[model samples]
Target: MTDTNRTCFMKGQGAQPRRDRSQLPPRKMATLIIVLTMLFFLAAAHNAAAQPQKPQPERPLVFVPGILGSRLVDDNGTVIWGDRNSYLNFPKLEIAPSGPVTALHSDGRLVESINVLGPFWTIHQYDTLLHYLHSLGYIDNETLFVFAYDWRLSNFETAKQLQTFVDDPKRGRLQNGQFDLLSHSMGGIVSKLWMVKEGGAARVHKAIYMGTPFQGSMNAFETLSDGWGDFTNFIAGGLPTVRRVALSFPALYELLPTYDKCCRLGSPEKYTPLDVLDVATWRQRDWLPSEYRANGPRGAAFERGLSEARRVGELMRQPIPGVAQVMIAGDYFDTGLYLYVPTNRQSWRDWNFRRSKGDGTVPVWSAANNFSSIEGTEPSFQQHATIFADKYLQNKLERELLNTAPPPVKHDVLGEIDTPKHEKRRLDLARADLSPRIAEPGANATVTVAFEFETGVTRGDVQPTAQLLQRGAADAPITLVETTTDADLAVRRLTFAGSLVAPAVEDTYRIDINVAGQGDHAVFLTVLSAGRRQP
Candidate 1:
C-alpha cells in the first residue's frame, strides 16, 4: 500500500497539491495584467493634469460721481443735501439746526450713501453702474466700490481722502495693487488731482472721465452772476435758496470760466473773456442793476470765495501726467456760449444769450479741453444730466474698462441733426398723446405734438408745420398738417395723420417740425416690420 500511495502522489494522481495563487496564470499573462493596471492609473493622472482650471477674476472698480451726486446726512441720519423734499422746503427746514451735513462714519470707515432722490436730485447715483458691474460677476464691496465725499469742499481735499480710501488694508487689494477708476463731471477733477498730486497715478491702471469741465464752462459764470434764473424757480422751488447754498461752496466758483481758455470772438477786433466776479461788468452788460453790483455782506463773501476759487483754477491748469486716461465729452445740445447785448431794457426772461455746441451745461471745447490727449470723445445730443444714461457712452466705458490694451484714440463727433431755434421757445414734443405707441410698417398712426413758443412769438408768425421721414432717407417725407392752435399766443399744437408704410427693412423714422421763422426740430421714432415684436 505504501509503495502504491507514494507512486500516486509522485505522479500527482492520489491527492492534488494546492495550486499557488501567483502561479494560477501563465508568467506572460501575469506580467501583462500588472502592466495594464499601471497604465490605467498613469493615464488617469495625465488626464487630470491636462484639464484647465477656472480663470482668476478681474481687478476691482471704483466709481467717483460728479457734484451733487453724493448724499450728505446729519448725525441723526436725516438727509441734508440729497433729500429733494428738504431742498424744496429750503429755509423752512434749516440744515444748520439738524447739525452740518456729515457723512455716515463707523469704526473709522465711511459707508457710502446709496440714496438717489428722483431724476432732479440724483445724489449717490450709481445704481445702474453697480448693477451692470454685478451682472458681469463683480461682487459688491469685494470688487466694486463708490468713493463719495462732500462735493462742496475743494477737489484737492477730496483727492487726499481718495488716496486714503485706496490704501486702506481693510479693503481687499486690487490686482497687483492697481484699480480702475470711473469718474464723472466734477469728480473727474477730483480724480485728476488725486492722480497728479496724491501719487494715485501709480495705483491706478486705467481711468475713464465723462463730461469733465477741465477748461471751465461759461454757463458756470453766468450761473454765479445771474443765479440759475428760471431753472432754479421752476425746478428747484426758488432761486434765493439755491443761490445762497451754491454761493457757500467754493467748488462752484472754481467752475467759473477761465477767461484765457473761454474767450471767443466778441467784436471780431477784441476777444472778450468772461469776468464773473466783476460787478461793473455785470452792470455794463445790463445783467443786473448798478446797485446790485457786489453790495452788502453777500458781496464781501463772494469776493473772499472768488479769491479761493482763483487759486483752485490755477492749480487745476497743471496737466495730469503718467496715467492712462480716457476722456469722454458731450455736445450737440444748446449750451451758453456768450451773452448777447440787450437792444433795450429787458427782464431775465427776455435776456438773449447766444448758444453754441455743448452738452447744455458744459461747452464742447471745455468738456474736451480742446481735444487734448482724449482717448475717445463722443458727441452726444443728450444734456449733461442725461449723458450718463446714454447706451453708447455706457458701452464705451465698459469696453475701455475691460480691455487690457490701451484704448484707441477715437474722437467720434455725431453732428447736430436739427439746430434748435431760439432756446427761449422751449419747443419740445410732449410724449403724452403720441399715436400708435408702436410704429409698424403698413400701419396707420396719429401723433399729436404740442409746441410752446416764447411769450412774444405769435402763432400766425410761427406757421408751424411737421413732416415724417425715414431716418436716413431725406427725399421720402410724409407731410403733416396743423390740426389745432391754442388760444394763448404762446402755445400751439400740431398733428400728423396717415399710414407710414414700413420700409422693406427695419429702421428708425423721425418727426421733423418746421416753424417757418424759428427753426427745424426733429424727434426720433422707431419703425419695425409688420410681424416683428419689439425686443
Candidate 2:
C-alpha cells in the first residue's frame, strides 16, 4: 500500500478515500457537517420561497350608524333605553374580520331594551332590517366598529371625539379596510362634521347620508311659536345658540366659504332653493337679487354658517381621496296635495309638509345635494329600497344623491328624468308589444314582438310578456287586449296570411302599447316594428 494506505492499514481499518475526509479532525469535520446542514436548510428555504404564498382574505367591514340614534326597541317606545340618570343606550353591528359581528352601536348600553324605543316611529321596523341582512349572510367575519357620540352636543365637540377614535395609535396596527358609514337625518350632519372637520375622513372609505339637513330646515324656524322670532333682542339676538346652529341650509350656507352669486347677499332663494326644505315654497315667494346674498348683521349669521359648511367641505377635497360620500333624498309626499282646516290658527293645516317616502322630515331635493345646480331629475325610486333596512342600499342611495358615490353610481340617481346617460343604461326589458302600424296594402308584411327579463342582484332565468293594443282606424274603433292570463304575453308575428284582411287605409292607423310589471319584478318595455311606422 502507498504511505497513505499504509497509515490506514496500520490503524487496522481500511482507509476511506481522503477526498471523503472520513478521517478529518473532529472539530473541522463537525464544522463542515454544520455548514452543509445550514446550506441544505438555506437551499430548502429558497425553494420553498419560490412557491406562491396563499392569498390573505379580505378585511372585515365596519358599520358606522348615524348620529346618536340607537337600533334598539323597547315597550316604552323610547328608541334608546335610559340608565338610572335617564341616559341613553344604543345598539351596534359587529362583524368579525374572520366571523360574523352582529352587534349594533347604542348611545348608551346596547344590552337592555328598557332604554330603547320611542325616539322614532320606525325604530323597531328599522332593527328588523339588521336581522334581515344577517339572514342574508352579510355580517360574517367582519369587524363592525359602532361609534356613538352625543350629537345633541355641538358638532365641533362630537367631531373631536370621533377624530380621537380614528387617530388612536393602536388603530394603525389594525388590519382592515375603511369602514362603511350609514347615517340618517341629524346623524348625517354629525358624520360630516366628524369625517371632514375631525379628520375621520382618513379612516372612512364611504359615507351614506339619509335625509340629512345639509341646509337649514324651514320647519325648524317654523316650529318656534310665532312670537319666538320677536325675542331677537333676548339672549343676544335670536339666541346665539339658535343662530349658530348649522342645521338649516341658511345656516349651513353661512359656514361654507364658497357661496355662489345667489348666496352673496344672504338668502339662498335667489339662484335656487334646491338645498332648502320645502323647495316648492320658493315658487310662491317673491324673490329679488338683494334677497339672494348676505348683506347686514343677519347676513353675518349667514356668512358664519356658510363658512362652516365650506370648511367641512374643504376637509373632504383631496386628489384621489379615500372617502366616498352619498346622499339619499325623498320628495315630500303631499307636496301638491290639498289639506283640510280645523280652525283659524290651523288655517287649512297642511301637515303635508312631511315627505311621503322620506323619514317625515327630509324632502327629496333638500336631502340630496342639489345645490351644485346640476340639471337633472333626482332619482325618486329610493323609497322602494329604504323600506328594507339594508344600510348598503341606503348608503348607495345617499352617496349617489350627494354625487359622492364611487366612480360610477350604482344607485338609482335618475328618478324619472330622461337624460342621455339614463337612456343608454340597459333596461331590463320584461315585455314588448309589436303591432302593425297599417293594415298594409295586402302586401306580405309582419310585426314581431319579443319580451325578456333581467335583474341587477340575481343571475337567473327570466320570462316576460308582450301585450297589444289595436286601433283599426280613427273613426272605426279601438280594441285593447283585456286578458288576465300570462298567455296575453305571447309573441305575435302578424303577416298577410290566408284570409287575413290587409290593414284598412284610413285617416289614421295606429297602435298603442302599455307595459306593466309582472311576478315579483318591475319590467321595462321596448317596441320594434317591421311595417310602416306611425307618428
Candidate 3:
C-alpha cells in the first residue's frame, strides 16, 4: 500500500474506540439534563474526545531525548515526566527520593556527579525543557510526553521500543490520536531508522529533529571511542559485547546503508515510511567535542564515520517526501576564551583549544541547512552562552517550534542597518567593539548597533545579520528582547539598527554580527551608546 494510505490506516486504528457522546439514549440525556439543571449549568459538555479534537494546546509533543533518556529518571527509579515504561513516570514522582540522591549506574556503581548529565537537568533529573516552556506560555501542564529510552540499545532495538510504546492500545494517544516526535541528535537517527526499519513511521504525525547529525558528525568516531566506557557503564553498566555494539559508532553509521536496501524498495514486506513535519538544527555550548590527546591517535573507524556523515549530507541536499525541513541558527556564544594547552612531549606539539564555540565540534556553517538564511546573525557569538538555565532561550526555541515558521528563505529580508562612523572599520579586522557606555540591564534596554563590512564584501554577495545581548547583571533571569524577524539575509549599508529589549539581568549584553551567505565577507560591529533602564 501507499505510505499515505498506511499512515491514514494507522491513525484510524488508534482512533477507533472513542465513544460517541452525541448518541446518548433519551433517558440518559434526561438524567444528564437533570444533573446540569440542579447545578444551574446552561451548556452541555462537548464530546471533544469523540469528535477529533484539534491539534492545539494539547498537541502531542513527544520528547525524544539524547542518550539513554536518563534525564527523565528520578532518584527512586521512577519515570518522572516520561513514558509509562520509562525508568520514572509522573505518578511515581511522589514516592521518589528527594534532597540529593545519587544515581546508581547499571553496574551498581554510585556516581557522585556526572557533568555530562547537566546539573539543572541531569540524566537522572527531569523536566528542564518542559518547565521552561511552561514559563514561556508555550505549553500547559501535562501537554508534553517525554519519550525516554535507553541509548545503549541498537537502532533496531530502540525503534522496537518506540514502536511498542506508540502502538500500545492504552497509552500513546494524542488529542487527535496520532503520535508526534521531537528527537535530538542521535535520537533523530534512531527515530527515523525505526520508522523505516521497524514499521513505526506509519503512526507518526510529525517528527522534529534538533541538531541531529542526520548526515552524521565528524567527531562521532572520537566520541564513540571515549563513550565506549560510558556506554558500557550505562548498558546495565557492564563491558558486555552486546551492549558495546549498541552504541558502537561504526554500527550506527551502517544503519543508513542497511535500510536503503531493505525498505526503499517497492515491496509488501517493506517497513513503514517517514512523515516529518520539521527538522531543526540546534547548537549551543559544548556542541563540539574536544580532541583528546589520550586516545593513541584517531582510528580508521573515526575517519570512516566522518566520511560517511559528509556523504549523507550530500544525500540530504534534496528535500524528502511528505517532509518539510527548516534550519535554526543560534549565535549566542558565551564560553570562555580559548585556552591553549600544549602537549607535554617537547618534540610533538598539540594544543587543547579550551574556549566557547570552538569550530572543531559544530562550525556555524554546519549547524543549519543553509547558513545564508541568517546572513547577519553571528553563530560564533551565539556559541558563547549555554542555554542550560536560560528561560528565554528555552521558551524562544519552543515558540519557534509551535509557530511552525518556515526555514529562512534564500531571499528573506533580515533587517535594516543604521550605525555611526565611530563604530565603522576596514577589512582584515579580527575583533569588533561592544560599547561599555551602552550598558543596560539585559531585560530592559533598547539596543542600536552599526556594522562596517570589509571592502571585499558586496551588499548582494553575503547577507550579514547582527545579534544583541545583555549579560547577567547581579542575578536576574536572562530575557530576549522583541525583534522584527528571526533572520536577516539581506542587509546593505554601513550601519544597522538592532532593536530588542535587553534580556533579563542574568545575561551580559554584547553584540555579534556574522555573514551567513556566500563569498568571503568580513565585518565589524559596534554597540552605539544607549541608556540602560529597569523595566
Candidate 4:
C-alpha cells in the first residue's frame, strides 16, 4: 500500500438474473417486458418496506469528512475549534512551544462535523454535500450517518473509532452488516485506513472518495509548511494566528504529499526530483517543527507524527478486499501538481508551486492513485470546495450510489495507467533566474523568468500575474508585490519577473514568476543568518 500497488481480491459476485423474450411476439414481448419491470420494481419496494433495515432501498451510508470538517469540543462541552466566528476569535489549540509534544487535549471529543464557517459570511463546508445526499434520499442516522472524530489525533485512532462506531449494535451496525461510505478529502484516508488496516472492509460495500488525497496533496504540505493561506479551504485562512493554531494537528501531517516524484531540488529550470517521503529529506530541509529541533520529547513526537503520516500514506494506497473504491476528482483548474523546492537544506520554508490539472486542492493524478487507476470525475473544471454540489457530478454520484454506473476498469495489469501525458503538453518552464541570491531576512531580491507554453490554455481564462507571496504556517501569505507578464520576443519566451522585500526572518524563500493559464517557475533565495554562508 505504501508503494501504491495493493491488489484487491474480488469475492464471488452473485449471479445476474436473466429473462427470455424470444418466445413472445414483438408486441407481446414489449408489453411483457414493461409488465415484468413494473412487477420487479414492486417486489423490490415491498421487500424494502417490510425489511428491518431503513425503509429506503439504499444501503446504510457512513459519511466521513476531511480534517477540520468536524467541530472540536473540550471538557464541560465547551466549543474549542469549530467557532463560527473563528476568523476573529482564532480559538487556540495549545501546542507548548517546547515539551513532550504529546497530543494536546481537554477531554476533547467531536461535537459535530463542520457545515459552515464564518456564520456572518455564510461559508459552506459539508453542508452542500450533506444536503445533496439528503435530496438523494439518504436519511440521517437511519440510512445515513456522519462519523465525527477529533481530527487532531492520528488517523489510526480515528480509524479505530470508525470500526467501533460501525460495529456498534446501537448505531451503524445494520441487519445485513453492510453500508456504503461517502468520504470527502481527509476522511477518505481515515475511511481507507479503517477498511484496510482495521478490517472494516467486511462491512463497507462501496467507498466514494470526493477530492480525497489518496496519494496526498500539495495544499496540505503548503498549509503545514506555511500557515493556511488557502482561501478555497477557508479553514486555513491567511492569518498569522490561524496559521499557528493549525500547526498542531496530526491530521495535517498525514495529508502531506506522498505521490512519486512530487518535488525537485534547486531552481525550476535546473532541478532533480527527490523521494519526498524520506525523513532525511524533511530533516535536511528542516521541515519538522522548529520548536522541537532543539532535542526533546516534542521532537520525538514530531518524528512519530511523520512516521504515522508515512504509515497512513502506505495504507491509504492499499485496497481492501470486497470493498469497491471510486474517486471523484475535479480536473479543470490549474493545480500545483509538483513543486520546485529550495536547495537550501538549511531550513524548510516554501513549496514553489507549478500548476497542472487538479481540483484546486488534490491533483487529478493524486486523486486517481497517482494515475494507477481511473477516476469517475475527469476534465471537470469544478473547484474542490463545491465539487459535490456540481450538477454533473451529482448525476454521476447518483449512478455510482445505485451501482448503476459501470465499475471503473483498471489499466492492464502489467501496463501503466494511461498517463495524462505532460511531455508534449502543459506549461513548460524554460528558464527562471534570481539575482543577488544572498540576502539577510527583510532584504530585497530581484528575479527574472522565461517560460514557454505548449498547452492550448489562453490568457483570457487565466489573468496571468506575478506575485511575491509570503510563506510558512504561522503567517498569512501577504503579497509583497504584484506584477504582470509580457512576451519577451527576443528570448522567444513569455516572461514575468518581480522583486520584493524578503520575509523579515532568516530562512529560505522563493521568487515565483507566475504565468496565469500556463504555469509558474520558482527560484529559491536563502536569506542566511547573520554570518552563515549558503551551502
In angstroms, the error of model 4 at 241 is 5.0
Which one wins on TM-score? 4
State the RMSD for candidate 4.
20.2
TM-score result, candidate 3 = 0.40
Reference-based lDDT, each prediction: 0.56, 0.36, 0.36, 0.61
Candidate 3 structure quality by residue, lDDT tens digits, 1-535 = 9977877787888855445677898899899989979666323344443575322333456666554344344457543333323221212221111211223222211221222211111222225555554554444324565555644334555667777756555453443455556665556666666666665555565666554444333333333334333322342233232223322333344322111211111123432321110111101111122221123132333344334543444443444444333332332222122222222321111212222222223323334434334353223222211222232333334544453433333431122122232232232212223323233344233333333333423333323455543333342222222222213213322333334444433222334455332111111122222331211
Q: Indicate whether candidate 1 or candidate 4 has the larger TM-score.
A: 4
Segments of candidate 2 deviating more than 4 angstroms: 1-62, 71-125, 132-142, 167-177, 222-322, 332-359, 372-535
lDDT tens digits, residues 187-231, model 4? Answer: 888888888888788887788888888888888766655553333
Rank candidates, lDDT, best first: 4, 1, 3, 2
The count of residue-pair clashes in candidate 4 stands at 5
Worst 10 residues of 4 by lDDT: 410-419
What are the TM-scores, per candidate, against the unseen true structure? Answer: 0.59, 0.38, 0.40, 0.62
In angstroms, how far off is 349's CA in candidate 2?
Answer: 14
Per-residue C-alpha lDDT of model 1 across residues 315-397, encoded as one tens digit per residue:
66676665677777765455776654344543333444566666777777677766344335665434565466555565566
